[model samples]
Target: AQSVSQHNHHVILSEAASLELGCNYSYGGTVNLFWYVQYPGQHLQLLLKYFSGDPLVKGIKGFEAEFIKSKFSFNLRKPSVQWSDTAEYFCAVIYSSASKIIFGSGTRLSIRP
Candidate 1:
């Protein structure tokens, strides 16, 4: 079985501030890691993913995440933030063999302009 843990429940930042969200997962076998974001009233959107190849993956809106296999962690980072970036972010782990996806308790981010 796979599980995810998000260290922060909520984060507040000013416009142009840097952002980093911590995420950790536990799984024995190979799995897919993903980061998703949901705006105030919008549907969840994929932020970045790591299935294979490079550990560093970049997503929309200048967001990027790095998968650390040894530590079983995938942390998200953004160089600069905007008020429009306020949203909920979730970390997900998908077990390829079982085709099951597990998500971490989301982290809500609020950006002040």
Candidate 2:
């Protein structure tokens, strides 16, 4: 079974501050990683994903993630965050042999204006 872990349960930052959320998985096989964000009243939206090809993947809303195979990590990052970016971020993984997506505990990002 595969599982995702998000070290930070809550994060606070001011507007324009850099953001980096930690995300790691426990799978060693072929897998796909994804970063999803859920706003205060909206559904989950795909931020970014890494399936194959380039290790660095750019996602919506100026977000990006790098697939580090050796470390089993797919950390999400953004150079500058905005108040609108405030949301609950989730790290997910889907193994090639599995049909379900394993999601992390989730990290709540709070941005101050």
Whose TM-score is greatest here?
2
For every candidate, C-alpha RMSD to the true structure in Å: 1.0, 0.8
Residue-wise lDDT of candidate 2 within 1-113, one digit each (tens)? 57899999999999999999999999659999999999999999999989999999999989999999999999999999999999999999999988999999999999999
* TM-score of each prediction: 0.95, 0.97
Clashing pairs in 1: none
The all-Cα superposition gives candidate 1 an RMSD in Å to the true structure of: 1.0
TM-score for predicted model 2 compared with the true structure? 0.97
Candidate no. 1 TM-score: 0.95
- Cα lDDT of model 1 by residue, 40-95, tens digit: 88999998889999999999999999999899999999999999999999999987
